[model samples]
Target: MTSAHPAPSNTVNAPGTLAAANEEFWSNSAETIFNEPWVLDFQAKMRAFLEKNIDWLGIVNDRTSATEGAEKKMLDYACGDGFLTRVYHPFFTKCIGIDIAAGMVKKYNEAAIELGLASEKMYAVKGDFSASVLELPKAEDVASTDLSRDEFFNFDFVGVALALHHMEDPETAIVKMVERLKSGGVFLAIDLLNSEGVSESKDEEGNGGNHHHHHQGGHSHGHGHGHSHGTTATGRSGPAGHTISHDHPAFSIELVKDMFDRAGLTDVDIIYSDWKLELPFVTDPGAKLLVARGRKQ
Candidate 1:
């Protein structure tokens, strides 16, 4: 029962200053985390996780570019470091990643360039995809006809992975993401859940910022576990290794269903991975993770 994401003693910061504050934290540490060796492993885990959990290739590969015929487009919202974006790049003809953290987006673009993704096919932009607060293409711009024509809303597929737990309002975020999709577009989400099945308590995350997702890795805001679930916890574990805990109440599977239903997504389905994941970076035993998918009507 090792603890996951033990913030390196020298650099743990405060809990999210606010729902939006997590972006600031990630902006400051974006480069450092992008350079971390564990990030590479994390990327691999992301790819494997998606492969094991969904028919990701089939989903992204389903669409074809109107112009190129064989190409498809995707958006990776809240795409920290574009780790997941890079993973899915090979499948889409064009993949655009957006992040609240400008530095993270910059690093994402740099990584894409380094991979020689042909600028037009893969790129990252700095923006808050969670809302339409920012205006694009000023009044004088030729392409600025209707705000509806904004590039932000154009995507064949959208993905939000390991990020919903950090949101100020996961439900609104889900609704807005689905709104960005064209009719029949797909939305995929993967996030951590509060498996304790216990009602949330103020003290659940504990103090001194020992909560999950407020990781020691300098990312500062996430849902990775930092505590123990004990013998009362029902899940089985693999070889003894480090475990991850949650700082905020884990979103229950039911909550996820409700959000999807409220968003009017059809064909919604969710599943919990049967086995526990052991990461090279975090030590604690892990929790059951949920994978969900739906299509916009």
Candidate 2:
């Protein structure tokens, strides 16, 4: 890992690609596109990425042993379908997930139960992670695990994936995620990089723009605001060969590194991974996703 701070010499304002309409669009899509076979395949790809890079067992065992078997906690900010939550459930003693979309939260809970995860192990709540603590849900009411909001902040690991671009203030979101981690805790984020500010949203067949489905599919360039069910593509194929499209805002590596530095994190590093999604008719060999990771001081 590199120890030096990133060169913030040529800072540029990240375009608010779908910041305004992302919430509404994603909320409507929660019920529709998230359940598509192709969308599910994309989510699997994301899970695979986490499984490859995240040492869940190592982190959990190390922390739990240090605390004399005290339960370790994990926070999934903007958790969406709780894809990462389910993966980390067995490793952490307590897992908490928060999302802006109620439908997505509902599905997260249902999926957790379907996976046979006990309620005490996983809890999904509908709320904006970017909101002030005063505006957050009652931590006690959010789950059976007895943890207060302040107590909830002391997490051993925090993961924010593919959801930062939709926020009105990505930097604030990063800062807040860092604030929630315990000392020496890890914070990891993976999302597209907007190096050239490319915001085009058209597939080969000229379907609707902004092809931002959850997990994996094709490259979408829009701010997804947590729309739930029905608005996303449901057909086998649209006017073209594939179905569904939504825009996703890409974050530049310089901007990502800057966010980590400002959040007071140490040992920050940027990694480029060959990320892609394979569907029945379409194989999206996606652009290099920027993974910004660090430890809280």
TM-scores for all candidates: the values are: 0.67, 0.66
lDDT to native, each model: 0.56, 0.55
- Model 1 spans > 4 angstroms off: 1-19, 53-71, 131-149, 196-249, 279-286
Using lDDT, give the best candidate's number.
1
Model 2 segments more than 4 A misplaced: 1-23, 56-68, 131-148, 195-248, 277-286
**How displaced is residue 104 in candidate 1, in Å?**
0.6
How does residue 39 of candidate 1 score in lDDT?
A: 53
Cα deviation in Å at residue 48, candidate 2?
1.9
228: Cα error in model 1, Å: 16
- Tens digits of per-residue lDDT, candidate 2, 106-170, equal 66777678878787777776556442232434556453232246756888888887676455566
Cα deviation at 38, candidate 2, in Å, is 2.8
Question: What's the C-alpha lDDT at position 18 in model 2?
Answer: 30
